[model samples]
Target: MELTYKNSKTIDSEQLKNLYNDVGWTAYTKDIELLQQALLQSLEVVSAWDDHNLVGLIRIVGDGLTIIYIQDILVLNEYQNKGIASQLIQDVMSRYESVRQKVLLTEEAPDVRHFYEKQGFQSCDKGDLVSFAKLN
Candidate 1:
Protein backbone atom coordinates (compact mmCIF):
# COMPACT_ATOMS: atom_id res chain seq x y z
CA MET A 1 0.00 0.00 0.00
CA GLU A 2 1.20 3.48 -0.86
CA LEU A 3 1.00 6.09 1.86
CA THR A 4 0.96 9.82 1.32
CA TYR A 5 1.72 12.46 3.95
CA LYS A 6 0.50 16.04 4.20
CA ASN A 7 1.28 18.90 6.51
CA SER A 8 -2.19 20.30 6.75
CA LYS A 9 -4.90 21.32 9.20
CA THR A 10 -7.90 21.00 6.92
CA ILE A 11 -8.82 17.46 7.85
CA ASP A 12 -12.51 16.67 8.15
CA SER A 13 -13.78 16.12 11.67
CA GLU A 14 -15.56 12.91 10.77
CA GLN A 15 -12.38 11.49 9.33
CA LEU A 16 -10.39 12.55 12.38
CA LYS A 17 -12.98 11.06 14.68
CA ASN A 18 -12.91 7.77 12.83
CA LEU A 19 -9.16 7.52 13.03
CA TYR A 20 -9.16 8.36 16.74
CA ASN A 21 -11.81 5.70 17.26
CA ASP A 22 -9.82 3.17 15.28
CA VAL A 23 -7.00 3.64 17.76
CA GLY A 24 -9.32 3.40 20.80
CA TRP A 25 -8.85 7.04 21.77
CA THR A 26 -12.48 7.27 22.74
CA ALA A 27 -11.80 10.38 24.79
CA TYR A 28 -11.41 12.49 21.69
CA THR A 29 -13.71 10.54 19.36
CA LYS A 30 -16.51 10.92 21.87
CA ASP A 31 -16.65 14.65 21.25
CA ILE A 32 -16.33 15.30 17.57
CA GLU A 33 -16.97 19.03 17.91
CA LEU A 34 -14.32 19.50 20.54
CA LEU A 35 -11.89 17.43 18.54
CA GLN A 36 -12.49 19.51 15.45
CA GLN A 37 -11.94 22.72 17.34
CA ALA A 38 -8.73 21.41 18.83
CA LEU A 39 -7.45 20.39 15.43
CA LEU A 40 -8.37 23.72 13.97
CA GLN A 41 -6.40 25.56 16.58
CA SER A 42 -3.26 23.45 16.45
CA LEU A 43 -0.06 25.16 15.39
CA GLU A 44 0.70 22.39 12.92
CA VAL A 45 -0.51 18.97 11.88
CA VAL A 46 1.01 16.16 9.85
CA SER A 47 -1.21 13.46 8.53
CA ALA A 48 -0.89 10.21 6.64
CA TRP A 49 -3.32 9.00 4.06
CA ASP A 50 -3.81 5.66 2.37
CA ASP A 51 -5.23 6.93 -0.86
CA HIS A 52 -8.57 8.36 0.29
CA ASN A 53 -8.33 7.07 3.83
CA LEU A 54 -6.94 9.07 6.75
CA VAL A 55 -4.66 6.51 8.32
CA GLY A 56 -2.55 8.49 10.78
CA LEU A 57 -2.02 11.94 12.27
CA ILE A 58 0.29 13.98 14.49
CA ARG A 59 -0.83 17.24 16.03
CA ILE A 60 1.23 20.00 17.60
CA VAL A 61 0.36 22.94 19.79
CA GLY A 62 2.38 25.92 21.09
CA ASP A 63 4.11 28.90 19.68
CA GLY A 64 6.50 28.01 16.89
CA LEU A 65 9.37 29.85 18.56
CA THR A 66 10.06 28.60 22.08
CA ILE A 67 8.43 25.27 22.78
CA ILE A 68 6.29 22.85 20.86
CA TYR A 69 4.21 20.14 22.42
CA ILE A 70 3.34 17.04 20.49
CA GLN A 71 -0.29 16.78 21.42
CA ASP A 72 -1.07 13.63 19.58
CA ILE A 73 0.50 11.05 17.31
CA LEU A 74 -1.68 8.24 16.20
CA VAL A 75 -1.80 5.63 13.48
CA LEU A 76 -4.63 3.29 12.82
CA ASN A 77 -3.91 -0.15 14.26
CA GLU A 78 -3.64 -1.75 10.84
CA TYR A 79 -1.28 1.02 9.77
CA GLN A 80 1.05 0.81 12.77
CA ASN A 81 4.62 -0.61 12.71
CA LYS A 82 5.29 0.85 9.32
CA GLY A 83 7.63 3.84 8.94
CA ILE A 84 4.61 6.14 8.90
CA ALA A 85 4.95 7.28 12.51
CA SER A 86 8.65 7.85 12.10
CA GLN A 87 8.19 9.79 8.90
CA LEU A 88 5.48 11.92 10.43
CA ILE A 89 7.73 12.74 13.38
CA GLN A 90 10.70 13.46 11.15
CA ASP A 91 8.63 15.95 9.27
CA VAL A 92 7.65 17.78 12.47
CA MET A 93 11.15 17.72 13.93
CA SER A 94 12.54 19.02 10.67
CA ARG A 95 10.10 21.90 10.71
CA TYR A 96 10.84 22.76 14.33
CA GLU A 97 14.49 21.79 14.34
CA SER A 98 15.47 25.12 15.84
CA VAL A 99 12.93 25.17 18.62
CA ARG A 100 14.38 25.05 22.12
CA GLN A 101 12.06 22.45 23.56
CA LYS A 102 9.94 19.71 22.06
CA VAL A 103 7.69 17.89 24.47
CA LEU A 104 5.20 15.09 24.51
CA LEU A 105 3.18 13.30 27.20
CA THR A 106 2.49 9.67 26.60
CA GLU A 107 1.77 6.46 28.40
CA GLU A 108 4.68 4.77 30.06
CA ALA A 109 5.41 1.74 27.95
CA PRO A 110 8.66 0.17 26.85
CA ASP A 111 7.69 0.12 23.18
CA VAL A 112 6.48 3.69 23.37
CA ARG A 113 9.71 4.85 24.94
CA HIS A 114 11.73 2.93 22.36
CA PHE A 115 9.81 4.46 19.50
CA TYR A 116 10.33 8.03 20.71
CA GLU A 117 13.92 7.33 21.62
CA LYS A 118 14.52 6.14 18.10
CA GLN A 119 13.26 9.53 17.01
CA GLY A 120 15.80 11.25 19.27
CA PHE A 121 13.54 12.02 22.23
CA GLN A 122 14.98 11.64 25.73
CA SER A 123 12.67 10.67 28.55
CA CYS A 124 12.32 13.07 31.47
CA ASP A 125 13.84 10.61 33.90
CA LYS A 126 16.79 9.91 31.68
CA GLY A 127 17.37 13.60 31.10
CA ASP A 128 17.01 14.53 34.77
CA LEU A 129 13.96 16.64 33.97
CA VAL A 130 10.56 16.58 35.62
CA SER A 131 7.14 16.74 33.98
CA PHE A 132 3.78 17.38 35.55
CA ALA A 133 0.33 17.52 34.05
CA LYS A 134 -3.17 18.30 35.14
CA LEU A 135 -6.15 16.65 33.46
CA ASN A 136 -9.62 17.97 34.00
Candidate 2:
Protein backbone atom coordinates (compact mmCIF):
# COMPACT_ATOMS: atom_id res chain seq x y z
CA MET A 1 0.00 0.00 0.00
CA GLU A 2 1.28 3.41 -0.94
CA LEU A 3 0.36 5.37 2.13
CA THR A 4 0.49 9.15 2.04
CA TYR A 5 0.24 11.65 4.85
CA LYS A 6 -1.12 15.17 4.76
CA ASN A 7 -1.04 17.98 7.26
CA SER A 8 -4.59 19.19 6.75
CA LYS A 9 -7.43 20.45 8.91
CA THR A 10 -10.28 19.74 6.53
CA ILE A 11 -11.89 16.36 6.22
CA ASP A 12 -15.32 15.35 5.01
CA SER A 13 -17.63 14.14 7.72
CA GLU A 14 -18.30 10.83 6.03
CA GLN A 15 -14.63 10.03 5.57
CA LEU A 16 -13.83 11.10 9.07
CA LYS A 17 -16.68 9.05 10.44
CA ASN A 18 -15.55 5.99 8.58
CA LEU A 19 -12.02 6.34 9.84
CA TYR A 20 -13.14 6.84 13.42
CA ASN A 21 -15.45 3.86 13.18
CA ASP A 22 -12.76 1.72 11.64
CA VAL A 23 -10.55 2.46 14.57
CA GLY A 24 -13.37 1.54 17.01
CA TRP A 25 -13.76 5.08 18.24
CA THR A 26 -17.51 4.82 18.06
CA ALA A 27 -18.02 7.71 20.44
CA TYR A 28 -16.53 10.00 17.82
CA THR A 29 -18.30 8.35 14.89
CA LYS A 30 -21.67 8.82 16.54
CA ASP A 31 -21.56 12.55 15.96
CA ILE A 32 -20.22 13.27 12.54
CA GLU A 33 -21.00 16.95 12.64
CA LEU A 34 -19.33 17.47 15.97
CA LEU A 35 -16.37 15.43 14.88
CA GLN A 36 -16.04 17.41 11.70
CA GLN A 37 -16.19 20.63 13.59
CA ALA A 38 -13.59 19.39 16.05
CA LEU A 39 -11.30 18.50 13.18
CA LEU A 40 -11.78 21.90 11.63
CA GLN A 41 -11.08 23.66 14.88
CA SER A 42 -7.91 21.83 15.80
CA LEU A 43 -4.66 23.76 15.68
CA GLU A 44 -3.06 21.05 13.58
CA VAL A 45 -3.96 17.75 11.98
CA VAL A 46 -2.02 14.99 10.27
CA SER A 47 -3.93 12.34 8.35
CA ALA A 48 -2.92 9.17 6.59
CA TRP A 49 -4.53 7.92 3.43
CA ASP A 50 -4.20 4.92 1.22
CA ASP A 51 -5.22 6.36 -2.10
CA HIS A 52 -8.62 7.84 -1.25
CA ASN A 53 -9.21 5.83 1.90
CA LEU A 54 -8.70 7.60 5.18
CA VAL A 55 -6.72 5.23 7.34
CA GLY A 56 -5.31 7.17 10.26
CA LEU A 57 -5.30 10.60 11.82
CA ILE A 58 -3.92 12.74 14.65
CA ARG A 59 -5.14 16.06 15.94
CA ILE A 60 -3.64 18.69 18.20
CA VAL A 61 -5.07 21.65 20.10
CA GLY A 62 -3.14 24.40 21.84
CA ASP A 63 -2.00 28.00 21.63
CA GLY A 64 0.68 27.06 19.09
CA LEU A 65 3.39 28.73 21.19
CA THR A 66 3.57 27.46 24.76
CA ILE A 67 1.85 24.10 24.97
CA ILE A 68 0.69 21.58 22.40
CA TYR A 69 -1.65 18.82 23.41
CA ILE A 70 -2.08 15.79 21.25
CA GLN A 71 -5.81 15.33 21.35
CA ASP A 72 -6.13 12.17 19.36
CA ILE A 73 -4.10 9.65 17.42
CA LEU A 74 -5.70 6.65 15.80
CA VAL A 75 -5.15 4.18 13.02
CA LEU A 76 -7.47 1.62 11.54
CA ASN A 77 -7.09 -1.68 13.32
CA GLU A 78 -5.78 -3.25 10.16
CA TYR A 79 -3.31 -0.43 9.80
CA GLN A 80 -2.04 -0.59 13.37
CA ASN A 81 1.50 -1.83 14.04
CA LYS A 82 2.60 -0.58 10.64
CA GLY A 83 4.13 2.62 12.06
CA ILE A 84 1.39 4.85 10.67
CA ALA A 85 0.54 6.22 14.11
CA SER A 86 4.19 6.72 14.82
CA GLN A 87 4.70 8.55 11.57
CA LEU A 88 1.76 10.82 12.24
CA ILE A 89 3.18 11.62 15.67
CA GLN A 90 6.65 12.14 14.23
CA ASP A 91 5.22 14.63 11.79
CA VAL A 92 3.53 16.54 14.58
CA MET A 93 6.61 16.49 16.80
CA SER A 94 8.75 17.65 13.91
CA ARG A 95 6.39 20.52 13.22
CA TYR A 96 6.31 21.51 16.87
CA GLU A 97 9.89 20.65 17.65
CA SER A 98 10.46 24.01 19.29
CA VAL A 99 7.39 24.00 21.50
CA ARG A 100 8.17 23.98 25.23
CA GLN A 101 5.62 21.41 26.37
CA LYS A 102 4.03 18.53 24.47
CA VAL A 103 1.29 16.54 26.12
CA LEU A 104 -1.14 13.73 25.46
CA LEU A 105 -3.69 11.87 27.58
CA THR A 106 -4.33 8.24 26.85
CA GLU A 107 -5.55 5.13 28.52
CA GLU A 108 -3.12 3.46 30.88
CA ALA A 109 -2.47 0.44 28.74
CA PRO A 110 0.95 -1.10 28.64
CA ASP A 111 1.14 -1.16 24.86
CA VAL A 112 -0.09 2.41 24.67
CA ARG A 113 2.45 3.56 27.22
CA HIS A 114 5.15 1.63 25.43
CA PHE A 115 4.33 3.23 22.11
CA TYR A 116 4.49 6.74 23.51
CA GLU A 117 7.58 5.92 25.49
CA LYS A 118 9.25 4.65 22.36
CA GLN A 119 8.53 8.03 20.80
CA GLY A 120 10.30 9.84 23.68
CA PHE A 121 7.35 10.33 26.00
CA GLN A 122 7.62 9.69 29.73
CA SER A 123 4.85 8.86 32.16
CA CYS A 124 3.80 11.67 34.46
CA ASP A 125 5.03 9.85 37.54
CA LYS A 126 8.32 9.11 35.87
CA GLY A 127 8.75 12.78 35.06
CA ASP A 128 7.58 13.95 38.48
CA LEU A 129 4.56 15.64 36.96
CA VAL A 130 0.86 15.41 37.71
CA SER A 131 -2.02 15.39 35.26
CA PHE A 132 -5.66 16.07 35.99
CA ALA A 133 -8.80 16.37 33.91
CA LYS A 134 -12.42 17.34 34.43
CA LEU A 135 -15.13 15.99 32.19
CA ASN A 136 -18.63 17.27 32.06
Candidate 3:
Protein backbone atom coordinates (compact mmCIF):
# COMPACT_ATOMS: atom_id res chain seq x y z
CA MET A 1 0.00 0.00 0.00
CA GLU A 2 1.23 3.48 -0.86
CA LEU A 3 1.70 5.80 2.11
CA THR A 4 1.91 9.57 2.34
CA TYR A 5 3.36 11.71 5.11
CA LYS A 6 2.41 15.26 6.03
CA ASN A 7 2.86 17.88 8.70
CA SER A 8 -0.66 18.27 10.00
CA LYS A 9 -2.45 18.73 13.32
CA THR A 10 -5.97 17.90 12.18
CA ILE A 11 -7.26 14.37 12.67
CA ASP A 12 -10.68 12.85 12.68
CA SER A 13 -11.83 11.86 16.15
CA GLU A 14 -12.77 8.35 15.07
CA GLN A 15 -9.49 7.86 13.23
CA LEU A 16 -7.48 9.09 16.19
CA LYS A 17 -9.39 6.88 18.61
CA ASN A 18 -9.05 3.82 16.43
CA LEU A 19 -5.32 4.28 15.91
CA TYR A 20 -4.57 4.81 19.61
CA ASN A 21 -6.81 1.94 20.65
CA ASP A 22 -5.19 -0.35 18.11
CA VAL A 23 -1.87 0.36 19.83
CA GLY A 24 -3.36 -0.29 23.28
CA TRP A 25 -3.05 3.34 24.40
CA THR A 26 -6.50 3.30 25.95
CA ALA A 27 -5.84 6.35 28.14
CA TYR A 28 -5.70 8.61 25.12
CA THR A 29 -8.67 6.96 23.47
CA LYS A 30 -10.75 7.37 26.61
CA ASP A 31 -10.82 11.13 26.16
CA ILE A 32 -10.77 12.12 22.54
CA GLU A 33 -11.38 15.80 23.22
CA LEU A 34 -8.34 16.12 25.46
CA LEU A 35 -6.22 14.21 22.99
CA GLN A 36 -7.31 16.43 20.13
CA GLN A 37 -6.61 19.54 22.15
CA ALA A 38 -3.16 18.29 23.00
CA LEU A 39 -2.43 17.66 19.36
CA LEU A 40 -3.64 21.08 18.41
CA GLN A 41 -1.30 22.71 20.91
CA SER A 42 1.75 20.65 20.04
CA LEU A 43 4.64 22.30 18.28
CA GLU A 44 4.44 19.99 15.31
CA VAL A 45 2.81 16.76 14.26
CA VAL A 46 3.96 14.61 11.39
CA SER A 47 1.54 11.93 10.34
CA ALA A 48 1.53 9.00 7.98
CA TRP A 49 -1.54 8.07 6.01
CA ASP A 50 -2.63 5.37 3.65
CA ASP A 51 -5.31 7.04 1.61
CA HIS A 52 -7.64 8.39 4.28
CA ASN A 53 -6.39 6.00 6.98
CA LEU A 54 -4.13 7.35 9.71
CA VAL A 55 -1.39 4.76 9.94
CA GLY A 56 1.22 6.46 12.09
CA LEU A 57 2.02 9.74 13.85
CA ILE A 58 4.89 11.54 15.54
CA ARG A 59 4.07 14.51 17.73
CA ILE A 60 6.61 17.05 18.97
CA VAL A 61 6.51 19.70 21.70
CA GLY A 62 8.95 22.19 23.20
CA ASP A 63 10.79 25.32 22.20
CA GLY A 64 11.76 24.48 18.62
CA LEU A 65 15.06 26.32 18.87
CA THR A 66 16.74 24.80 21.91
CA ILE A 67 15.01 21.51 22.55
CA ILE A 68 12.22 19.31 21.26
CA TYR A 69 10.52 16.41 22.93
CA ILE A 70 8.97 13.51 21.12
CA GLN A 71 5.70 13.53 22.94
CA ASP A 72 4.26 10.62 21.01
CA ILE A 73 5.31 8.28 18.26
CA LEU A 74 2.94 5.51 17.37
CA VAL A 75 2.01 3.31 14.46
CA LEU A 76 -1.00 1.05 14.12
CA ASN A 77 -0.15 -2.53 15.07
CA GLU A 78 -0.72 -3.73 11.53
CA TYR A 79 1.57 -0.98 10.27
CA GLN A 80 4.50 -1.60 12.58
CA ASN A 81 7.94 -2.77 11.38
CA LYS A 82 7.33 -1.68 7.80
CA GLY A 83 9.71 1.31 8.34
CA ILE A 84 6.80 3.57 9.25
CA ALA A 85 8.12 4.32 12.75
CA SER A 86 11.63 4.75 11.47
CA GLN A 87 10.47 7.12 8.77
CA LEU A 88 8.42 9.06 11.25
CA ILE A 89 11.40 9.49 13.53
CA GLN A 90 13.61 10.42 10.63
CA ASP A 91 11.13 13.02 9.51
CA VAL A 92 11.11 14.65 12.93
CA MET A 93 14.85 14.51 13.26
CA SER A 94 15.26 16.20 9.91
CA ARG A 95 12.81 18.89 10.82
CA TYR A 96 14.52 19.61 14.13
CA GLU A 97 18.07 18.95 13.09
CA SER A 98 19.24 22.25 14.43
CA VAL A 99 17.76 21.75 17.88
CA ARG A 100 20.34 21.23 20.62
CA GLN A 101 18.46 18.49 22.43
CA LYS A 102 15.94 15.87 21.35
CA VAL A 103 14.30 13.78 24.01
CA LEU A 104 11.68 11.13 24.56
CA LEU A 105 10.67 8.93 27.46
CA THR A 106 9.45 5.48 26.55
CA GLU A 107 8.99 2.18 28.29
CA GLU A 108 12.28 0.43 28.81
CA ALA A 109 12.24 -2.60 26.59
CA PRO A 110 15.06 -4.21 24.65
CA ASP A 111 13.25 -3.66 21.39
CA VAL A 112 12.40 -0.08 22.25
CA ARG A 113 15.98 0.72 23.19
CA HIS A 114 17.25 -0.93 20.08
CA PHE A 115 14.89 1.01 17.87
CA TYR A 116 15.88 4.42 19.27
CA GLU A 117 19.54 3.52 19.41
CA LYS A 118 19.35 2.53 15.78
CA GLN A 119 18.05 6.02 15.12
CA GLY A 120 21.13 7.52 16.90
CA PHE A 121 19.59 8.14 20.32
CA GLN A 122 21.74 7.33 23.34
CA SER A 123 20.21 6.07 26.52
CA CYS A 124 20.35 8.35 29.57
CA ASP A 125 22.23 5.67 31.48
CA LYS A 126 24.87 5.70 28.78
CA GLY A 127 25.57 9.35 29.38
CA ASP A 128 25.86 11.81 32.24
CA LEU A 129 22.17 12.63 32.24
CA VAL A 130 18.88 11.65 33.80
CA SER A 131 15.23 12.41 33.21
CA PHE A 132 12.20 12.58 35.47
CA ALA A 133 8.52 12.97 34.83
CA LYS A 134 5.33 13.35 36.76
CA LEU A 135 2.44 11.42 35.30
CA ASN A 136 -1.06 11.30 36.62
lDDT per residue, candidate 1, 6-103, as tens digits?
88888888799889999889999778888888988999989999998999999999998999999999999998998899999999999999999999
Better of 1 and 2 by TM-score: 1
lDDT of 2 by residue, 49-98 (tens): 99988899999999878899999999988889999999999998988999
Can you write out model 3's per-residue Cα lDDT over 1-136, one digit (the tens) per residue? 8999989898999999999999899999889999999999999999999999999999999999999999999999999999999999998998899999999999999999999999999999888998888999
Which is the leading candidate under TM-score?
3
Q: Per-prediction TM-score, please?
A: 0.96, 0.95, 0.97
Query: Whole-model lDDT for model 2 versus the true structure?
Result: 0.90
lDDT of each: 0.93, 0.90, 0.94
RMSD for each model, in Å, please?
0.9, 1.0, 0.7
Pairs in clash, predicted candidate 2: none
Instruction: For residue 17, give model 2's deviation from the true position in Å.
Output: 1.1
Query: What is the RMSD of candidate 1?
Result: 0.9
Clashes of 3: 0
Which 10 residues in a row give candidate 2 its minimum summed lDDT? 15-24
Q: 1 or 2, which is superior by lDDT?
A: 1
Q: Which ranges in model 1 have alpha carbons more than 4 Å from their true place? A: none
Give Cα distance to truth, residue 99, candidate 3, Å.
Answer: 0.2
